[model samples]
Target: MRTRILLAVAAAATLTIAGCGKTPITPADSSAAIAGLGSEHVKVGMAYDIGGRGDKSFNDMAAAGLDRAKEELEIEATEATPEGGDDEGRLGALNKLIDSGHNPVIAVGFQYVNALTKVASEHPETTFAIIDDDSIKADNVVSLVFAEEQGSYLVGAAAALKSRSGVVGYIGGVEIPLLQKFEAGFAAGAKRVNPDVKVRTQYLSAPPDFSGFGDPDKAKKIATGMLADGADVIYAAAGGSGAGALQAVAAEKGATFIGVDSDQYQSADAQLQPVILTSMLKRVDNAVFQEIQAFIKGDRAGGTRRFDLKTDGVGYSTSNQALIKPLTPKLEQLRQQLYDGRIVAPTKP
Candidate 1:
């Protein structure tokens, strides 16, 4: 879908009226005001990550953001999914969006960082926004990164509290700094709850392969091993690999699992639903929408934009009301402490 709207970036100048006062207008403020202006029909484009759409995770959350933008901003938007799992394929799709005249293109995942950086630099007139990755340094590009550790910490505490075996586990897609943030926070949260709790960590691959994220069978195997080792709650930071953990939890007796990115309560089958404790909510949708809105309003802030728990950009899911009701108040307290600077979460692994 495409919508066309006229948008102009006003130049800075001094306006003088006869027998009146003179007013000075700065270029930055004028550009911001112009970007803020939205018409009945605006065109936007979105590029999905490797997982594509309907993974019920990161890509899905990003799609939701695009959908919301369509409804609220009356934007005519279309999304392009990569044909194959290569950076070239991803860049090709993004190029198609730009060549087709889609302004303000938004890349859904960190995997698009290099592609976006290259494209944004090539097309300085086009605006771009990226989530989860920050490889791009162009002024026309906006990078949205999150503090996954803060949300993971709270969920880790919940996992430790609910674990009967006193052994918790974390499974990650890769060992990169981003995934490491999730692992470290979860481990810290679990340890904070129970000093004696054993937190086991595992990654699908050591060097990090994008394909490993969607391997459910691999996730199931890792999760089953953790369960066999007396792990009661396993937190999955693996993208598609998380599905395997859910499957293992469903098959295993008396084992629980925590999901990442989005709430997996409804994503799982009826039997597995009960076993899903909660998800570490990374509010990617909010971040995406806010950035797009800013771009439309000419208020684009070019640089790395951090989304933390304090900003309500990242958090633990409360969608599973029955499972999370008892823990909400305490979690809120911790969230407040983090926002008030009373609590500090470690960023490094």
Candidate 2:
């Protein structure tokens, strides 16, 4: 089923690029025009990370943006997950998109750097946008990264304030610089609020193992341990793994969990719903949608594009209206301070 979808997407992308500059095509026209070129109407393609679709984190958020482009911008877009493995699958998907003639092929995670760097160089005419990691530099690629530290800092402060015990916990999917930025910022924020606060940090896996991000068993075990050690609030930066952490929090009363990447409060299970105190919002959907819009408008660029707290790219969610109401005033003040240069959150690990 997935392979068939990828082939269809590749064919559509080929047709779109082959038909460019001919006529403004609508959905009805797409079939005929693409058929003439022996292609389809797949104009935009997004290659998802290892976490893939339905993780309720990074990839899901990017998919939302692609969906927006399809609706608002009248572009035909589809998402592809790497088939073989993380590295091989990412490269294969990227190559397929470019070979099919997609203009701005979107890569959804930082894990695509090596694949994108090679693919972007080979196909200079193709534009690429990567999220999270930005080690790659190419004239045809745009790097979209967020200030997780700033938002994590705010959530950390909130956790500190709400904790009956001075102990808080941070559970990461994998120990990478990106995750480290969350750890550092959360620690800094907690310290700023309460110097004596004890912040316990752990990762589902060490390194060379990206599989941990989606591992629920490991996350649950880690969270359970932290809860037993007196952690009242646990901030989970572990993609799908965080779901397990939320599960642990729900099982134990008087414990709270902080979400990441999106407004998880809205999507979490009803049993664990109230346990989610706040979520660190990384506006990947907004960024992806904007980038796709730019491509449609012919404004795609290269180099790194930073989305921070100042730009409203990163922050905490107020999805639960009643809960967020009280924090609004303080959040607004902190937002202004971040914008006015009064506060500088760490960008890199």
Candidate 3:
């Protein structure tokens, strides 16, 4: 029932992935080595965001990372989602994971900041990593964040280049500063390409109401309105609600949808694939994998790690090659500018 929350704005300083010199835990000896972690093999806990694993977007990417660790690194894993989808639920989920002997628990959303802050203090020995948030300043916690604006900027330019109506739309799951980064970067990129480009923006929900991430029906209504208003290209950063935008865009001829967090076109339905012009790939899976990899190597430093274009942490998908091919050259040029520090994407709207 706690409504208090700390909003995480993107950090300005970019840090590379940290490395550890501790002896690596081989698959055969990992079980006996990680004594306090779990009963058997090295066990990791995954606490998913609102829509959980099957969301086919953010949460799914986190799951994919965990799955990769399990297969490649030979680690045991247990995953859980918030039953009530609130701060209390987040705390409960974390507690459940730790109680089950899973160490190095990864909370797959910024919404877990408060819950993680409390649980982390209680379990000082248990290492924790939070995705999309860097507000926690604890030794046992690491913030796995991404340069969302950079990726969003590229897609926004793509949206503008692909738009015939001169107006593009942005849909945010919630009206938080974090989500604002996506809107800001998208608008800025669009304007950079076409100074007179029109950007339509809206949020499905506000603070204390995170239901927006899961409410596709409302997103559908909003996207429908944007399309009717002459938006030919729409970029949705609204978690699972983005599925609705994809469906809406699919039904409208000559309209395109930009996906976020994952390569949504691959996970999207076969019929909805064509409408997906491109997706802003926030490599949450790679972040999760790196966190687990560092942990297994006995690197317990809970410092913040930033994933940006320099590290290939975020990017645009190339699934719809035919549609995106023509725009590739320009997009790649813009991407290089971002990577070379020639262009800096806005982190705020």
Candidate 4:
């Protein structure tokens, strides 16, 4: 009882300070509601990857959805964070959340694949959602997967078209298959537009070393070196670390960058916005909100829910509106061509 009160209070405090996400609510009303939620609280537990909430990228987008659920679906939510990428620690955290009575829990990244599936099997009545990976199967598990490559392809095309040096670059946070899709699509899109264009792909770190997602300095160093190599435009698929790449672009004139996972042009530091040409929008918030609505409507089918370009789950951003206006038609044509199956994005570099 004491713990619940403390947690509820903390959450209320956070709500008061937070910008009210995609679904905002009045603090006084929400606080009273949170305190009284109890067994009736449409509770959702979220387990965050690596850098957790402050990434201002992937995790922040997920937080937006969860925040929306709090106000719109009247869900009481709690989040768990890992020290790094420790699978065991992640499992422990997830199980504890389940034991504490939060149902319809979500694991924010593929690192939780094995642990999430195992736990979901033990609690069949409770709905479970795993982001980024969909191979897991169980009556209670729901896969929240996205077509990231489709969005990457658009940004890749933009980078190629905007590059005066004819060489653009791509940087992946981790060398995992998920980030691989970003690298592959970026390279392919660039090649599609300018067959002679050079797309340089670099992975900051390998699996089990997810620090790549959080390390801005390392990304900055790599972006610097890549820029020195004559790459005028760079696309970064690294999480928070991608911000570092933007910093590098900021330092150089006429150099632009591509962002990932969120509308980072809007999310980034003001000075960095000019350098961020556009971002690949992976709508994690929309996915989270949709699932919560499904649960509210009693529609858990225990299957994969794909948020692809076809469903507006992903796309390119125009936060730098004036900069991209001239290229919108071309980009739109490519997007439609890809969506209509006229163009296919390759997933391997």
Candidate 5:
């Protein structure tokens, strides 16, 4: 089943807010969905992370994948976002979606790890997919994990190559293992090129307090400090807070910013686009589409499936020509080294 999961990323021609083209539907509104479409149609459910559908970063990428499934598979889809901060809220949402009879439910973010593990155990007959987590040891649970460090490594190199001050910065949403992966890759990639380059780092928050992912003000403050200290390039892996980081870089006379999860350059506001040097692309939408498509084909087998530099599951974006054009040759050389195992991005900082 894992072998069947390897497919190209879905090309999203449109990046509007989730449920943009259709009347909005949610898992709790199963009755409304049933009335509009018969039960004979397949129903899929997705539970979004902190900022939900319109985050324009992590969660939005997941929403795009679900949207594509709705269009191509004709599946009745319902989306839900948690309102509380604890695992209880996540557990309730998962239970509610499963009780609503939506099969192959997909949970976004590692925050859902414990909740999904408990729920998947109770509902052995149901299949579940989780992104960014691979600890669940159940046959009904499919762990769709990504090598985020691989992409971060590429953008880290880009930052070093373009840095005029010999210093770059990394602003993370949280000081967790996941965000650390980004910090590690970025620093490693930068030093790999310039050796003397300095990579400054800061986290907006720590574990059990995920608000950092959504707080742009704090991120901006941190980015501004880094820039003032001589960082001419900064990479943000701070989810919704990344907007604040980008804003800080834009205000700086010559600072450049790198984005994460999706093509932040493409998704960012028009006024903020030029400051974006490049983005580390993580194809969560592609993973979601493959999971749903597999379910529709009656393939319910579940296990850990990984997407990384070798599989094109993760890479750097090329949207900002002014910053990326001259550096392409060097970046590509490092990319090939990563793909061929000649170079490995450190997973820890």
Candidate 6:
């Protein structure tokens, strides 16, 4: 089920947003996948987004995939975290891995688009995968992007259904098309469920100022303000900043917090766990594992590989015991509607 479609980094083709974008990258034939991963150990490298591994969100899921590739396919993988989110910082981290003789380097965030585009062309001998971004048109780079808005719609519906207060809040790490899609689907879903529901949205920072993803203090303050304004249910799409929002939720007694990317219900902070009503489970792990798997199979063509509801790339996490259980039937109906073209989650603010 491997087909190829050229993806533009700056523009998108007519791929359905609910279907993981343009290409239908079903798992490559199993025989080829196994043969591609012969008995030899494959060396894989990764550069994480800001906040790195302990962020317990996007980067952690990327780590899980790399770890699984090592354990199951006998690959030797090393990861590097950037000191800053700027192009220079990301370039240094990527160059460090390349210097260590790592091939098929993986850049975990769209913030690395500039660095990856420049470096990938300079080193055609190496292969690279960029998660959450597909603007690069290099033949050596694979765009491991997902239909985030589709899954976000599901959780947004959940938030609307569970909110005792008619108002809900959304917190985003950075203001970009990537995070903006989350905001769009969330607000859309809430409005779809109940037209009058007020959805307050805020972004901690904009592009080039990528500190928002890991800034707990600012996220906490933002969440505190949103909750104080009658937002009983809040969703945080700000990576580690979400942890701070959860902290605020924990202190607010009756408030509920929704997580994004990873399952916040499994947080190390036990107090944060119970406060998490649900998480928009974006399967960063699946996209990472599959792209790396394809690379192993000698499939290094640069193009768009879409992961969506059909590919199990995104959904609502079951971290808490049935937080969305009562709404499962309705959720499933809405999910099918998304797939069948009845519902279209917006990708813009």
TM-score of each: 0.87, 0.85, 0.88, 0.87, 0.88, 0.89
lDDT of 4 by residue, 1-349 (tens): 0100111112332321110011223365654434532445577898888778978899999998898778755778999887646878888879878999988898898889888878977888898888898888777788888778888888888898899999999999999888988888888888888999998888889967778887889999999999999999999888889888999999989999988888887877787888888888887887787776666656655788877676557888876886777777788888888888999998777
Looking at candidate 4, the ten consecutive residues that score lowest on lDDT are 1-10
lDDT: the better of candidates 1 and 3 = 3
Which 10 residues in a row give candidate 5 its minimum summed lDDT?
15-24
Cα lDDT tens digits, model 5, 1-349, are 3433554432222222110011112334333322323234678889987668998889988998898778755788888888776788888788888999999899999999989989998999999999999888788998898888888888899999999999999999989998999999999999989999999999999977888888999999999999999999999999999999999999998989998888887788899999999888887877787778667656787788787765456788888887788888898888888888999999999
Model 6 lDDT tens row, 1-349: 2345423120111122322112223343434335435554568999998778877899998997787566545578889998876889999999999888898899998889999998998899999999988889878888888788988898888888888889999999999889999999999988888889999999999967888887999999999999899998899999888878888888896788888887767765775677777888787776777777767767788888887676667777655765667766777788889877788889997
Cα error of candidate 3 at position 328, Å: 0.2
User: What would the per-residue lDDT of candidate 3 be over residues 42-141, giving only the tens digit for each residue?
Assistant: 7899999777889989999899878867866679899999898889999999999999999899999999998999999999999999998888888888
Best by lDDT: 3
| Candidate 2 vs 6: which has more lDDT | 6
Cα deviation of 56, candidate 6, in Å: 0.2
Better of 1 and 5 by TM-score: 5
The 0-to-1 C-alpha lDDT of every candidate, in the order given, reads 0.76, 0.74, 0.83, 0.79, 0.82, 0.79
Candidate 1 TM-score, true structure as reference: 0.87
The TM-score measured for candidate 4 stands at 0.87
Q: After best superposition, candidate 5 residue 106: deviation in angstroms? A: 0.3
Candidate 5: misplaced stretches above 4 Å? 1-40
Query: What is the model-wide C-alpha lDDT for candidate 1?
Result: 0.76
> How would you encode candidate 2's per-residue C-alpha lDDT over 212-321 as one tens digit per residue?
78898889999999999999999999988899999999898888888998778878877778888888888787677767655654555676667665444677776665
Model 5: per-residue Cα lDDT at residue 215: 93
lDDT of 1 by residue, 160-218 (tens): 88888999999999778889999988988788778999999998876546666878899
User: Which residue ranges in model 4 land beyond 4 Å of their true spot?
Assistant: 1-41
Model 4 residue 201 CA deviation (Å) reads 0.7
